[model samples]
Target: MDEECSAFIDRDGDFMEVMCCDYGFRSGASRMYQQENDGRIPKNAFQLGWDNFKSELRSLRQSIRFDDYSTISEANPPRTPMSRAAYSVGQAALDSLDAVDRALEAAQVLEPLRPRAVTLDGVTRDSESGSKLINNCAEIRSKLKQLKLSNKAMWDREHAREQSGRGVETPWLIKGVYLSLCLLLDFLYENRPIQRFWFLETVARMPYFSYISMLHLYESLGWWRAGAELRKIHFAEEWNELHHLQIMESLGGDQLWFDRFAAQHAAILYYWILLGLYVFSPRLAYNFSELIEYHAVDTYGEFVDANEELLKSLPPPLVAAVYYRSQDLYMFDSFQTSQPMQNPRRPSCKTLYDVFKNICDDEMEHVKTMKACQDETVSQDIITRREDGPRVGL
Candidate 1:
């Protein structure tokens, strides 16, 4: 297995090497990798503003022009004189604006406060990251299609599993909301599996964010101080989900503007909802999270099984490799309350398949933790500390 994994990595390394030349190390599959700037100067405010202004203009022009404008040049002209004049004026105006922007940049009147280049850690720091990520993701999707993996088929299997058994008993309202959200996802992302996972991960972190917020509020009001450990675990869980979200993003999951807008707004709403639930009943909040986590486990499990061969053929995203194979796993072990503190989950990230498998396992661990929280037994679960070893706590 080790030899086979090495061979797979070696086989894919050539493609990545060539791809990286065009889309920097900070773009595409490796976009999420932290970039260190040794001596490069940061872009000034004026330069940044000009770039954004140009980008907006380009977007607006693209929206107005439905067809390709590239073919219309000196050799081939616009059909009407009015249209030709309009194009010429627009091009000249753009050129003048560019020249003015260049002059302003040369003057350096609006210098950036931070002139020195710094390490960029955010996954979406590079503007081209999403498009580049999507390019690589398209290849993976093509392979999956060749293998006959169907999103509808995957959804039906999960739906059948839900129908066969009562997974989690909750209030009618909670169950209704869960069902509605699941159905919405099925509808909105019918044939786009990666985008569906992206949306799921985007909202997945909200529960933990809300839980941490509520716990912090309780401590601030002096109502409780025992949840410090719980907050740590929740943060770890949020961090885990964040990586999942980034992994999806690196897979071109968030390439569409509509998808981003929808996922972000939904995440914010989910956060507030979870916060309200936590304020009223912590047990209920945990139960809600447990339901979602269970669903995630099933969804990812089905996805993995359905596209096993294709996934294994693709290389794991850089974010997955960094997170799963990191030297520091204190955060990773902190959330798995069901496992013995001494035995932490150290999942591999040799292929995309392993990444999804690890994520599925992570969601199952989340289910156990949520159940423990609801039953008030999480306090007894061992909390693993890097320096202090295993100690019983929340």
Candidate 2:
């Protein structure tokens, strides 16, 4: 099945690579669950609910896999140990949660016009039991208030501390663009980090695509051929962004129609703008990406630090486990331009915290690559590429 998907992807152009590869990963992850035996689920009722949920996900994946819209890309499908394995698992989990959400929505639609309070078996409104209940409710509310205040204070203090040495000073125009995006995202996704990250990754992949497009154009015109390896590195970088986007999607970042519309349109605009910049000056293009990637590194770092406790409580997504734990680290090392040639990255992904940490580290690698691209003497040897075979042909 994997080979079939890979072949299908390879037949398509580079433009379809990101989309098709993601679909293949999601489908492959779903297949993993489908292969598990019924004995894996405990006899408890709650365990049965989970088993049924997994079955539903399998069905959804099977349905989606054959759809024309889902099969529209042709690049080498990412291998089993690819980056952002969390996304593949998260997508299945997200669909399961969505099923629950839809059922709740339907229940709400069918609910009675007026709600009624029900008395407990041995309690009445005027009884001592009722008084105790009211008191308990009051106490619960007070604790919730205190908790919220404590959380708010912690976030504010940590955020300020994290901001102390984070930003990268860029050209005035680049700074303007960065500030505008930050403000716009703040306005649109206030207090919603997952959504913000989703939008960021969505737009983030565009610049790499722009870079590849320009490089391909230059090669086609017989103008420049030295960037053959650079294009592969950029694709790997874009591949990293693709997983980040999927992770955000699995977390319900694109749940709102307006958010989807905003991200898609923004991505389109960003691609075109970056393409123009690359056409005029590759340094400017790389500098802009460097700024954006640097900001991503800081944002993810702050998010992981501030939400360390909460993030740690969540299990690492399956795809994440596969990516970080699997033996193949070829694609994983392909984007890290800063790493010494002999010492490759081997980041962990034991928990959600580790996943975010790895993501931040990935962005820093992208920052390094972008900075390297700005240098006139960046050698192909410095840009990592797979030894097995060529990723693209010009």
Candidate 3:
């Protein structure tokens, strides 16, 4: 992808415009803005509630006017009229609530009560680009269905591979939890590849967040400062995963309220579980993360191999291009412990295929880092990097 094509790269634009465009319509932009701008003004409870109410009312009206509940038929072919009506009402209500939540989230950065000068040029451009990518992916998915190359087929292949495991023995509890999560994903996201990936990315970042939280707590308590470098690497990994999540969101992976609810809740639960595990035994925590990272690699690898032609035909999302081809790649290189700093990955982001390929490669890097943490060699790697001095990639 041309660097200039990315809305985020070499673009002289307002912060709000860039936020709305690069992060799409979702809350990713709002969350990112809050992270970058720590001193952002906060909306009062009453004003925030009012904005949410207005947004929800608008969303409800749109849903009533436009939504036809087509997915109800696709999911349950023999639905009765009463059932369909119930589903429609329930779905519309849930969608409105989700819209309100997203609106309130955006208000965190946009200041709904304030008259901010916001430009929609980049937002419109990225929206069109994202729609094209989604449509291309849909056509490709239909083609895959015709060829019997379905998500279930991929899941079964991964299942068989899991049965014939190579290594990495974990406690029975960890193994059970991991297997349960995989099974849940297989069941919940049978034909929805993008949503499946969205949920996966949502949960995938939790381990790193948990690790970083624990490390931070340790430092604050003056209990352990040895993990200072490890905290940086974990934060870098989390940042990388956040971009992956945004890319999936740009592809409309988070349109459904139910999917959002499930993924976010699962992510929160996993984060705490991982935090507890880290408190007890950091090795075990790393082991669990290693398992999840390996699973992500397998899943993304299967996705890229199965949809290579279609993905290549589609353009990369603006978020993917910005992330993979950004001028500053210090965060990118930090998480990749297995690769030498001098020989860091400079991956292409010209197509959707390249994006997924890079994500798979990133997961592999996470796997290596997690294994290093488990084996207690990550500290040495950090020390080696320090000795070599910071690279000029940034």
What TM-score would each prediction reach against the true structure?
A: 0.68, 0.59, 0.72
Best by TM-score: 3
- Taking the tens digit of each residue's C-alpha lDDT, what string does model 1 give over 24-115? 11243234444453345658999978985664444333322322223224323567898689878866765665565546556875331222
**Candidate 3: misplaced stretches above 4 Å?**
1-69, 72-152, 155-165, 392-394
* lDDT per model vs. reference: 0.69, 0.61, 0.71
Clashing pairs in 2: 9-74, 9-75, 85-319, 85-320, 86-319, 86-320
Candidate 2, lDDT over the whole model: 0.61
Error of 1 at 320 (Å): 0.4
Better of 1 and 2 by TM-score: 1
lDDT of 2 at 119: 31
User: What does the lDDT come to for candidate 3?
Assistant: 0.71
Best by lDDT: 3
Residues 202-239, candidate 3, lDDT per residue (tens digit)? 99999998998999999999999887778888989999
On lDDT, who's better, 2 or 3?
A: 3
Which whole-number lDDT from 0 to 100 does residue 90 have in model 1?
66
TM-score rank order:
3, 1, 2
Residues forming the 10-long window of minimal summed lDDT in candidate 2? 11-20
